[model samples]
Target: MHKRLSELAFGESGTVRYILASRHELNCLGVRVGKHLTMITRQPIKGPVVVAVDGMEVAMGLETAGCVSVEVD
Candidate 1:
């Protein structure tokens, strides 16, 4: 199903399909179309969402996470 990064549960995974943010920010994190990512942890109450991207851990804000679209099994 198509879902936002924020909607993914911890330990779940998805390929990044779209990011509604600046290209610089996107490239800095290596986020792009078809990039695989796993949800490591989602902070409670408007916190960041930690995701594992190619063995790298990155924290994304709730707002940014909401704009990231992903396809999941």
Candidate 2:
């Protein structure tokens, strides 16, 4: 199933399908389409969401995470 990255539960993993905004910035952070990502951490109260991509972990704001579409494994 495809869902917003921010909607992923902890430890859930998926491949990126698309991004609704900040493509350039997200790409620079290794979050481009087709990349596999795992939800590492999601802070409470509208905090940032951390995702693991490649061998690195990238944290993005909730709004940004909500813009990322991922195909769940």
RMSD per model, one decimal? 1.0, 0.5
TM-score: model 2 vs. ground truth: 0.98
Clashing pairs in 2: none
lDDT of 2 by residue, 1-73 (tens): 9999999999999999999988998999999999999999999999999999998999999999999999999
Q: What does candidate 1's lDDT look like per residue over 46-66, in tens digits? A: 999899988999898888888
lDDT for each candidate structure: 0.87, 0.96
List candidate 2 segments past 4 Å from native: none
lDDT of 1 at 26: 63
Name the lDDT value of residue 32 in candidate 2. 98
TM-score: model 1 vs. ground truth: 0.91
Instruction: List the candidates' TM-scores in order.
Output: 0.91, 0.98
